[model samples]
Target: MIFNHFHDAYLYTLAEVYHKPQFYNQPRGNRSREVLNYTYGIESPIERICYVPERKTNIIFNFAEALWYLSGSNNLDFIHYYASNMSKYSADGRTLTGTAYGPKLFAYGDKRLNQWERIKEVLREDPDSKRAFLSIFDASEVLQLENIDVSCTIGLQFFIREGQLYMSSYMRANDAYRGMLSDVFSFTFLQELMATELGIEVGKYYHNVASVHIYETDYVQTKTVLSKAKQIGTVPAYPFPPMPLKDNRSDLQVVFEYEQQLRQGTITLKPVDIDRLDIDDYWKQVILLFAVYQSIQQKKVIDHTLYQKLIPLYQMLVQQKWESYFSIIMEEM
Candidate 1:
């Protein structure tokens, strides 16, 4: 597609430069007026670089890797490269499930769904809850990952305004062009699903990939993509209709009552947002709590293993001054 907006423009620039950068180096008089060429050309007397990447090649690989996997097409050689770098892949870490390395990465975005569930709960309670959010921006966890030479964020963020859900994924770096497509579609799906459950409309999608870097390799194609994003296109409607709730009570009287409501087709799930409660202060505690819960479910038995997971949660709660919440959870455990 032709780029119509800055976002698409940025992405196309990255892919083009990274994939095949030679075509874009042709100087447009070296006047520094053409931002794309002036910035991308290296050691070529270009004065200013508008979008210099923080971790140049890693950003390219980061976006490219996601794109490659999602395409469900394999670059067998690259897969071998990833596999060969086994020492760099953190096999021992808190991933959702399954094998280590790239296999686990494919699922990193999926676990963000846990946050989606909480946000949905909040919206159901009070649609205006400014507290609605979920973030996968876990620094310690990201740091522990061995294969993190590539600068990137481990967490993504989600928020809601009025009845609309908004998401901003914070990346330490990104190959903007290729990654944006997947990021947009995936988060949009999350927004639409949550909106349907809450009886609200999906609104704006705000994406922030901290560094939208176009490498020297993809300069030409990036320009092509920029032109594409600039053109207007209809935002596609979400696929599903509003999902209905089902009751599964086993007690005879309860079952009868539930069935009666089901037959009448009048039962509605009330959605609420609890954000106004000023629970933002407790966000770290909440996320860590969930993480700890996940760790426990993994059958971790060693005291140190348990302590490693719990200590961070403990420290985070202390830092947030939510000692009471921490104490309550500890007592319950």
Candidate 2:
């Protein structure tokens, strides 16, 4: 089924998947949970896509993870800051293994083939090419490992049809409650980015998950979200701004540099810092949001002016009736 926004699709999946009683043993062998094979399509994946009402969905971490993947980074220190639990997923305690989609997508193996760049080149050369696909799963390592972090996503295929860029993501598995929202956020952001680079309108996003399951541990939270879903009306689609004219790669590099400095405690994020970047206003706000999040994490006083500037964007979260989630940061400020 197709939905206008990711939140509706996710809640619908939770409501349906929770009823399936088919329990299966997880690969780690430590847990057995209910599982179901599910597939759904998102018509407007980038519009009204952030699912902050779940409480478990960390907006800052989601953005950070997307940036991390786009930057082709595998540094544990960088990712671990956004999600501390990511440290647990590290195989060598320094970098992520099979689950590092960045390395696999941008620089796979010793040959270091930049799959994303190649896909862009393919699309540029032949817009109708069916070979413009980005692969994430590394079978060579995943097939042998029973206890490692294997990629849940198999690959993503892009199609340029009718002057629009459409994306189809194939996933081997999806944790409906805990992982699906973030996955959609990251992938669709990439889709929009590609559409921008291709100088076309963003088209439909088709998500196919082989196994969409909610673990027994997340049952209570899932039920809470489902109940909330019933009380809330459908969220209106966000009025997404047009893609900026500036090169996104350059903007991403600037953001990555600031992020690194922030992590190293070498630079404190300030209002002037936002002006220094050549990125679009929206992305500058996103970068500022990250800086605010870091301040909140450290119990430091936030810049009230910057916080006020973010109010309009925060109002989007409130419009979705996710004000409580946004209040977490507001309370600190």
lDDT (Cα, tens digit) per residue for candidate 1, span 60-122: 122223333332232343332323352333344322211122332233344524454566677
Q: What TM-score, over all chains together, does every model reach?
A: 0.39, 0.89
Candidate that scores best on TM-score: 2
Residue 238 shift from truth in candidate 2, angstroms: 5.2
Candidate 1's TM-score: 0.39
Superposition TM-score, candidate 2 onto the true structure: 0.89
Number of clashing residue pairs, candidate 1: 38
**Alpha-carbon lDDT, every model:** 0.36, 0.75
Worst 10 residues of 1 by lDDT: 41-50
Model 2 RMSD in angstroms:
3.1
Model 2 worst lDDT window (10 residues): 315-324
